[model samples]
Target chain A: MSSFAPVLHSEWLKIRSVRSQCLALAAVLVSTTAFSVLMCATLSAEDTSEAGFDPVRASFFGLNFGQIAAICFGSLAVAGEYRNGAVLVSLTAVPRRGLFYTAKLTVVGLLALAVGLLTSATCFVLGQAALGDLGVGIGEPGALRSVVGCGVYLALITLFAAGLAAVLRSAPAVMGFLIPFLLMLSFVLGDVSEGGGWVDFLPDRAGQQILLQNPDGPLNPWTGTGVLVLWVAAALWVGGRRLMRRDA
Target chain B: MTSIDVTQLTKEYGGRRAVDGLTFTVRPGKVTGFLGPNGAGKSTTMRLVLGLDRPTSGTATIGGRPYAEIDEPLRHVGALLDAQAAVGSRTGRDHLRILAATARIPARRVDDVLEQAGIASAADRRIKTYSLGMRQRLGIAAALLGDPEVVMLDEPSNGLDPEGIIWIRRHVRQLAAEGRAVLVSSHLMSETASFADHLVVLGKGRLLADTGMREFIEEWTTPRVRLRTTDDVRLSAVLAEKGFHPVADDDGRWTVEGARVEDIGPLTAEAGIPILELAGEEPSLEHAYLALTAGEAEYTAPRPTAAVQEV
Candidate 1:
């Protein structure tokens, strides 16, 4: 068996090379930070109660958009190889298909986690700076939980998309498959009364409960993150099977 | 030992047999040219050998071991089944770098292959910018990067210019000389005839010939004897007396088999036939190929007009 270093190195190289990945990463960083700053400016410009101007939720508001960018990047990290026919050479070199897929997921997954944590932390600090003595930061009740949850949420979204790509192997198709379910279906429908309880269990909707700014929500921050993590884990487990058994 | 042994290797998809019962052995220190027309299951066979596709019936083994069981199989068996089958957005060097990294080859070695393939200048360029010949060379470079004992390439000569063709021929011959097993596929026999020491010919999904180049040229190639004379009547009488059957083709050149040109000229002259043309058409590998796969050949080349003569 080949050492994991080179495999990881190759995977990292792939993540860094593509223009789309860079663009996606830039979108994640800039959008999250900018959105956090914008929310702070809005809060500071107007006089609002602590509940209405929760610094944690204000800073991490862009985690929603950040996750979308991360998911797109993560999905393409694996699927782009197939799109360009490099997967054949990749498989030819590694031979152990499952190991290859796992190595790729690990490197990209870790990178996503690092970026996710950094983005969330940076947004929290900057949002506090813009708070202008108005709202508390991570030191406040639920603020720390929200900040950490947002980071984990970003990483989970990326992993989930990466795993889905491993099975779909088509970036466009995976995006199409994920958009309605992750971005709209649950969140939009969950706002209504009848479907609210049921839609809250959907992956993205359940995942939002991790922010914890909504103290009266059905699930705690950890439980919401746990539900989303389970879904991501399932995607990876199934993707691993197809990666190993299916022809490259 | 045979570097590649494909025994009854069959690939079926939804009850359609893309390849069936393909059995052939590729040995070391020789170039085995795999010849087949398009859709003849050539690529499918190569994929099966690489274990990219599961065989429906039999197995494709390298040195008695399956491809999946071999760790870093590229080190033992390097393959280039498609020339432009690489990431288009990646630089040629980066492409090589990734493969080297995956196979655990040294980082510095990527430059060596770039130089070897005559693509050093283009190494930094994206594959999308490369010409067809450049991509083929890149593919060859990647195959040779492992310095493997066996190298398998499908239609490596495709889209190569004349000079590039000669370059590939020399490279394959050199690789074989270094004791590596070389398998190359092309639809044209003449393209690989001079380069391949042995051939594993395929038509449709079946093996047509598996032998050395020299033997295929000799055994199956038909030798044609041409004769001419001024005394056509006298020569005709002699031929009739000897029970020889002669039919003049378009150019009035009598194509007769089973006799040498020298023997025919003397025999016709002795019978008072004034000979104008006497030549024997030595069989080319092209002819042998035609004869071998006549039933399966999708395209039959017409005889050259010069080869047919007048009395």
Candidate 2:
């Protein structure tokens, strides 16, 4: 078996070598921060004090747009392998399919996490500044958890899309399915169903709960993130099995 | 010297056998030419050997272990199955760097292979901009990066120009001279004849011939005598009476199969058949390959009318 470290290094090189992947990473930071600050600046003090308004969630509004770039980063990193048959070269070099898959996800997950944390923290600070007197402090109740959880959420969603990309083996297909399911289908399903019920358990919906200061659903922030983790685990498992059983 | 040994390997896709009970060994210090028409399972066999695809039955091993079982398999065996199998957006140098990092190969080796492959000037360019010939050279550079004991290249000459072709022929020979086992597949019999010491011929996913290059041509092709006679009809009749089947060329020359020049010359002289020219024709590798794979080709184009009479 090949050692894990060198494989990790190689996977890292693969991700950074491509211009689109790097740009996607930058997009995650820029789009999320820019949109979050914009939302904070436009909101009035009247809305911040409202009982139903979640200031933390409002501050992280850019995540809605930023996650799309995160999805692109994850999917392109894996799906690019299938684009020109690079997977064949990859598998031949490693030969151990499990190790290769793990290393790849590890690199992608870590990179996304690093960028996610930076973006999350930056968006929070800037967004609060834009909100002026209405803004909440980082030390306030649930404020710290929301910020950290927001980063973890982005990382999880990135891995979630990457795992699906592995199974789908096409960038367009993965993006086509994931973008609608996260952006529209989950919302549509939530609106149609009363009391949230099982609809609250959807990966993106549950995961986004980590960004909310006051939880409306039955699940807490950590547990909501747990639901997304379960979804990610399932995707990665199926993707790994397919990679092993199928010929490159 | 490590060698590749395949035993009764078989691979079937959707109940159709792509490689059927194939067996061959590539020994060190020789270039083995893998010859077959398209869809003859050459690529499939190479894939199985490299562990890119699983064989349905039997085994393909390098240095006494399966490819996956060997730690750092690239250090033991290097293979290039497809030249175009790369991310087009990555520069050629970055592409090789990724592989080198995987195998723990030194970084300098990437530059070394780039220079060796004659693509160093274009090493930093995206592969999408590369010509097919340049891509082929990049592929070869990657295969040699490990400097393994065994090297397998499939259709290495596919997109090469005449100079590239000549360069690869010499490079392949040099690899064999260095005592490494090399297996190169090509449908061009002429190209194979130029570099390969041994031949492994496949037809419709079955092993048709596996022998030394000279022995293969000698065994599959028959000797023939070509003669231009002043009296073509009389010479044809005399050859027919002697139990020799003669074919007449459009050039008015007569060819007799399985006949020696020594025997034909004296026989026609004694029979008083006036012959303007008589000589023995050396059997070509193309003829031998065509004869061996005559009916086994899955795809064949119809012969043109103008060329039919030359046979």
Candidate 3:
């Protein structure tokens, strides 16, 4: 029954102390909103084919680029400790490996959640403004859910990257695997699978289910996010186990 | 007043043993020096104590429990295992702040420790810009943040300037004087000899010697008599005639082994030699360490070639 408040405070200070990690979080909002606005402004109603049009997803289109920033933020937060053996000092300060790790994850998770919500809401309002009559309202069906789901999606993606970073113990390694898998692999899998199959259940694709104006495939919006949550849980479990069993 | 007790602690990496059956107790109110050669398990043993690494067998306890079992561990034991273990981009003050927060210490203590470590002037600067000496100071500050009863520092004086080294020696002595247990590790015999009251020497992951500093030095190092006379040649001849072997150093001093000041004074007086300097030279910690680890050293540097030796 150890209190985690102090450890959480310390982890927050670690994240806030570095300029690059803060910049990474800020990028999540800026890149996602800016790219969504750009896409929305360029989109004309005449260009909308039934297969191509999805106003709710388009409003948060910058997520394609912004999510990378979120991943960088979470991965670096944990991986930076390993950069110069700072993890040894951290472990010394908090000898209970499980407590220290849980505190770290909590701080990163909350921060990502905050940034994710802000990015999702801002992208929605601004993208809808640019879309004119083509845009969906907050009261429209699935509109609020997609906006809120975008926030949860970003938070989960960041934690997922954080988990991988903890297990791998390097920012570059996490980025190398995550960036290609998220940006390229999803599209490649979609192409290989044609339209809809198990590929839609991939963590990213499954999570993005809520962001769509029209729900499709095997999972509902909440179930798709649940799949991403499972991925996050698996990653954190392995990372925590490694931290306890392996030598610092 | 708690003590660190390690009983038959062992750690194996793959097939090689990093720490093997090491047992020692570091009591409060003294600086126990952990001396060993490279790859001799000094760092590995410290890591095991801190619970940064799990032991393969046996146990290490602070007071009466393992490190993880203790609540508020920082308040019980403070350690500086590696001076360079700091985030480069964070300010020195912020680094201390983070650790201070984790220990549930007041924020004001961060400033106090920074001032105490003599790094107050550089506290606001980024750690990346700090010199190794500054980082060492910052690490020490972090260790003191919790004001624990036990302190462990590994190679604390390694990159320090003369003043910094003196500061550390005095600081460690003060910590011990305050009834805190201190365990400091170093490979340099001369450095540990300056301040450590007790010694724990290791070789190849095994304890080679564990005893008081003075006793270990006295038992292992030979006490010799050094004689500097007006007529060194005459002194050597007279000493040889008396069946005494005197080795002449480059400074024109004769080192007579297995003899005390009393033994050399009369011999020089009988030989009509004017003694300019007559002192008993106690063998240094370096000599005792060399003798203790003579056969157990992991790697030995090759002796100089004949040509270089002649020069």
Interface RMSD per candidate: 1.5, 0.8, 0.8
Report the C-alpha lDDT of model 1 over B248-270, residue by residue, as the tens digit: 66776676776667767767867
lDDT of 1 by residue, A47-158 (tens): 4564465566777777667777887878888788777577888888877787788789888788887888889888988987887777575678887777777777887888
Per-residue lDDT for B1-311 in model 2, tens only? 88889999999999999999999999999999999989999999999998999999989999888898878767778788889999999999999999998889999999999999899999999999999999999999999989989999999988988999998999999999999999999999889999999999888688898999999989888999999988888898889999999999999888899998987998999999888999998888899998877755434435676588876
A15-125 per-residue lDDT for model 3 (tens digits):
999999999999999999999999999986576555768888889889999999988998999899999899999988888888899999999999999989989999999
Kindly give the stretch of ten consecutive residues in candidate 2 chain B with the minimal lDDT sum. Answer: B294-303
Candidate with the greatest TM-score versus the true structure: 3
True contacts kept of each: 0.62, 0.82, 0.90
Off by over 4 Å in 1: A44-47, A50-53, A194-196, B227-253, B261-277, B296-311
Question: Candidate 3 chain A: minimum summed lDDT over ten consecutive residues — where?
Answer: A43-52
Model 2 local distance difference test score: 0.91
TM-score for candidate 3, residues paired by index: 0.92
lDDT of 3 at A108: 95
lDDT by residue (B150-204, candidate 3, tens digit) is 9999899888999999999999999999999999999988889999999999888
Which residue runs of candidate 2 sit more than 4 Å off their true CA positions? B225-256, B259-279, B295-311
